[model samples]
Target: MPDVTTSVRRRAFLLWAVAALAYAVDLGTKLAVVAKLEGRTTVSVLGDWLVLRVQRNPGAAFGMGAATTIVFTLVATAVVVVVIRYSRRLASAPWAVAFGLLLGGALGNLTDRVFRAPGDFQGAVVDFIAVRDFSVMNLADWAITGGCALALLLSFRSSPMTGTAGASDAGAPGAREA
Candidate 1:
């Protein structure tokens, strides 16, 4: 018997640690951008498709929402909570990694909201990754989007989160074939 009370909280800790790291990296880079670029500079990564264009965002994803950084901050907090809650239900390492990335992104943006510029809790997020004529974004945003995509793809596997029938539940008349 592997008699141990170590618990499986390592997964949860990993999720949070990844979040912290993402947040730190984002914040540090944004600070550096503000110091060096001073909110007006561009470094082309792939011609015009991907560029490191520094900018500040005071809204939700893709610069859709606006001005209400406080509201966005609240939403970020709620998202972090939900991510943590759902992460505990993950049974696959891939799923965990995906969720961790999403959580990390959220935390990163949230940190900016809570710490940088304007007011105490009324600060905007720093976005630097630019794509042609589209809105500027940062690494955290990419991680969040990518992780969510991965999680959705993994949902069709063996998770109870997906209502679709898997291998064991295949061809049960009422269920569709796997």
Candidate 2:
């Protein structure tokens, strides 16, 4: 069996690699959308079910909090810092991947918030990929959402109090043995 340190290191490497890939894809898609659809109208990709519509959003996901660009920027910065700080302790592959996705998504949006348009540290994020009856989002948004979902699933599957692989009923206050 591999040692704990080796396992952790391997997970950390996976986290960084995945983060880099996610960030790259997010940025690339945003740039391509902006360049191609700057002045064009929405182009339906799936017969109105999905469309390509370029938009600059100075807000949170789904275009909420339009007036809180700076605040979100600060929050993203904090998230990146916290993720990096905690990544050193990540021993699980799934958790590492989750954190990586989150970090990449945050950084992808943070780049636009810092360098896009309007002004520095207050720029709008380039958002495209509109879903009918849903919201217009980008790759970063998907990554973040996916990461959150995975994290939630992992949390629900593990022991809550002991951080173990399975739930324990042995030490319950009032429990019956099977």
Candidate 3:
């Protein structure tokens, strides 16, 4: 078996690699959507089930808190900081991937908030990809949502961030069966 440091190094690499890829994809898609769909009529992609349109949402999911763009920017910055700090002890592949997606998504939106429109840290996020009667969002939104879902699943399964069941299973009655 590899040493602990080696394992951690590998996991950290995986986390950052995934983060870079997710960030790139989110940024690329947003640029494309803005260039092609901005100011244009909504185009149906799946016959009303899915449509493409450009919208600048200065708010949270579903465009909530439209007046809190600066707050959101600060929150996103905090999230990025927490994720970086947590990565030091990353030992689970799933957790790494989840955090990676979260980091990428946060950075993507934060970029827009810092340098997109009406001023610094008060700009709107570019949202495209309307889903029928649902909300209009972008790739970053999907990444964040997916990461949260996976993290929830891992928690439900009692998966530890350390990638070991050692302490978590200790309290169970039959955990020490000989």
Candidates' C-alpha lDDT:
0.71, 0.84, 0.85
Better of 1 and 2 by lDDT: 2
Where does the lowest 10-residue lDDT sum fall in candidate 3?
A: 163-172
Q: What is the per-residue lDDT of model 2 for residues 51-146, given as tens digits with 9 covering 90 to 100?
A: 999989999877899998999999999989988987766647788889899999999999999998887799998889899999998998888898
Query: Model 1 off-target regions past 4 Å?
Result: 1-7, 161-178
C-alpha root-mean-square deviation, each candidate: 4.9, 4.2, 3.2
Q: Over 4 Å off in model 3, which ranges?
A: 163-178
Error of 1 at 123 (Å): 1.1
Worst 10 residues of 2 by lDDT: 159-168
Cα miss at 94, model 3 (Å)? Answer: 0.5
Which pairs clash (backbone N, Cα, C closer than 3 Å) in model 1?
A: none
Supply the global lDDT for candidate 2.
0.84
- Candidate 1 CA-lDDT value: 0.71
- Model 2 per-residue lDDT at 14: 80
Q: Pick the lDDT winner.
A: 3
**What's the CA error at residue 90 for candidate 1, in Å?**
2.6
